[model samples]
Target chain A: MLFSLDPRISRLELPESAPAPPDKAALDQFPTYEVFHQRKENTAYVYVGPVHAPEADVAFLFGKEQFSRRFPCTGMWVVPTEAIRVTEYGDDQQSVYDRLPLLPADVLAATDAAVTEAYDIFHLKKRGKAHTHVGQVQATSPEAALQAAKAAFGDQRPVVNVWVIRSTDLLRSDEADRDMWTTTPDKKYREAIAYKVQDRIDRFKQEG
Target chain B: MYGSASTHDIPTQATTGLENEDPILLAEFEARIARGEKIEPTDWMPQLYRKQLTRMIEQHAHSEIIGSLPEGTWITRAPGFRRKMAQMAKVQDEVGHAQLLYSAAETLGKTREQMLSDLINGKSKYSNVFNYPTPTWADSNVISWLIDAGAIVNQMANAKGSYGPYCRALDRICAEEAFHLKYGHDAVVHMATGTPIQRKMMQEALNRWWPAIMTFFGPSDKMSTHTEILMRWKVKMATNDACRQQFLDMYVPKILEIGLTLPDANLRKNEDGVWEFSEPDWEDFKRVINGDGPCNAERIAVRRAAEENGAWVRRAMQQPKAQYVRPLA
Candidate 1:
């Protein structure tokens, strides 16, 4: 809900003059604008939260007051929330998104013959971190998607590098193919299994 | 502290059902916690875990918003430009904390609207210290210094909690609150060491707030329970008494160094190294938390009014085509 306080108890009164137009009071509420913050000039803008404002300038000011006042933010961008298009992968839709890496021969043949479109892809790399995307915006892009990606998934956190590629160039492993990447028997190569520094140090102390 | 450290009295019967959960599932959950793994939004958890977390986080969210009211009054009447801007920024931070907390609690299934409605209707409680009046500029400074100090102690412990979202939010909040503590201490120091009139006002404010500040960590551990399970769950990170002691250990010397005296004559550190003081009036603590404090009605009334006044703004922004999706932290 946009508002949590009950509106029924409001004491606002209407005038007794001729009835007003239906949309007369409609302009009071502003559009919900998404805020992105750039922590440093070298970093990309990351999506922070949304602010309601009638115009871009007002939204920038509100964003500063709401999100940037105490935090160290090098820059900020505000765009209306509607400007962005999102494709969400939810729990119930697993069957559609979760496919195995090995596909039918026809599908593989079709993939090789397909034309590619430049697309900006974003990644949520870490938990509790806000840098949403990693790929650079392709110069040949739809006006709306590029702007949305820049505003919504632009550099807001420190990223070492950015890569530009066509949408068709990206390859994703299907959920059914999890074991292909994860079923390695080389447990000793993983840090959690490999690093026993504490154990080693204790053994050394005991030997000494 | 924007969030209350008050312990809700949980009945013994509440844990009876919790004991009957599938043992195998419970063991795995406990093992994850024991290994310091964070429980995420999609994680499997016991019903009691969700219930306790919701209540604690919801109450904390309420505390932040309600906590804004007392010091918010000083934004306009602040003596100078610096104080005015700083006070405004600080109060805004508290409200932002509320927004963050409400969103965190929403991950557990309770909607922000329901939490806020509970707050307005007096079904939920906030920090007891906020229920007292901020009658003077000095009073605001005292709250900033002492109450926020107490919050830092409590919240820092909670930052290490097993809940991923709550811990992440607390990490960010504690960083901001550290700045608030400095801001508060700076303001208090100026008053305490200033002119005679300023000194007196500061002293009186400190005196008035001491009792409430003492109660900020809630009653002593002897009177509270249902905490063993919470501690294991990493929900209640520290006992009310433990937090209070830590606050005293960190702050008492600083308070004295500023030439300010605590109101309680019995307040002192014993040979055992624990800070000792006259037990705060538990009766008053109970009364205040039960919505019978000096400014409870006024605080809620102001909040209600603000909500009413802003209803049009909220109404104007509603879009029929837009769908509400919780933000990923």
Candidate 2:
């Protein structure tokens, strides 16, 4: 066993007898709704976490108390968790965008025509950081997506603005052309590999 | 802010067989660590590294949750509205830390359910300080200021560790804990400099908590295996004695400055710059950690009751046919 057990105490047990199990009907777990927060007018909306509430209004209330009570937050949005679509990137599988090609104009038009409704798409950009993909909500109209997007990703972090677009509006790159996206040879532009300007300035001063 | 050292019996040098691992892969991993690169969730790592990280992070997560219980009882009885609100938020942040830590540990393959089960079943240990009771509001204040000060010392070191998820979580948690430290200090100051009644209460609380605070970083590192390999891996950032000395150096002056007296009469720093204090009773620590303390039964009972009561909520949240999926960091 990885954990150590005390031999002196043969067994440690709960002191009180267990209470009777709860009835199923007594379990009133509310639906989980994802919350978004907008810190100010110009910033992006951010996903905070999920709140359990029966309706969007109550969720917003819960989100306010849970997240923004001590923190500065201007606006909040709450949407049912089930309404959000998540596309998680995996190491074993190539990212969906990397494998799929952009739809042709005619195919895109046909698909757009088939579904007049558009959904919002949110993508998480990286691990261990927030504000990548605040996530999206499916709605019948652009106005609804705009409204729903605010509630879902709003108050968890400092988000000033939110992105609202039709799901069909998303474009993908061809799998064979993946190198175009993957290749980056401009080491000078990246701070990690770029030589220190301050060091060079100090060296020149010493030479002078 | 929850990586307090455990009072349990220290394990022997556990990383002995890593010499037989693929030397090239080990070298690459070490090089990455040397370069200050974080080991991500999908990154290749030694089995022992994973096990140690998992155990450490799991214990930390447990500490956060169990740590909440002491101060959590004061939320309702907090003297006024401001104190009430601040107390609630501070306790909530502790629970939030637990949630973040559990998720971070989950990345190492142990499920949150298993960790919580271990916690309730006494198969795992939390920070030994939590097993002590908070008898009065002043005790909570002492914990908020001193215990959290010790945690910051431990966590700030571990925050620079090689694991990506735990480091990130610690970053956010430490930010919140900074606020808690301020909140706790404000309360303690008010009591220390307040009327005689308040001062006495604060002093009594301080005297009671000082011993446990001394033992918070675990026993003297000189007496243990010293976790040398864990240090090399950046998993255990500082030794127990180092953390303890740092805590005393930082907080001892502040404690005395606040007109509070610690229980130890001989606690002082020597000319050699090492903290010299009467050693805390290691036998008492062992006995308490083995489940004989004043509040151990109460703490575990409360946690067990919480788990039992919350089972319905967990069951309700579960989807009938949904498969378990590991969370992405």
> What does candidate 1's lDDT look like per residue over B1-329, in tens digits?
46677546544454436677889988888887887666766567888888888888888888888898878878878889867877876787899888668767877877666676677777777788888888899999998888999888888888888887787678768877866787787788777777789989999999999999898898776532457777887878888889999999999887876678898889989999999999999898898789787777766776765766777777765555554444333
**Worst ten-residue run, lDDT, model 2 chain B?**
B320-329
Docking class of 1: incorrect
TM-score of each: 0.73, 0.70
Best by TM-score: 1
CA-lDDT, candidates in order: 0.66, 0.67
Q: Point to the candidate with the largest lDDT.
A: 2
Per-residue CA lDDT of candidate 2, range A1-208, in tens?
Answer: 1111221121334444344333333213345556666555446666565555545566666776655554556556566655544432322212323422344556544543554565664543333334334555756555455444545654333332233545544322234543432222432221112222334334433554
lDDT (C-alpha) at residue B237 in model 2:
84
- Per-candidate clashes, comma-separated: 9, 15
RMSD (CA, Å), candidate 1 to true, equals 14.1
Total residue pair clashes for candidate 1: 9
Chain A TM-score, prediction 1: 0.41
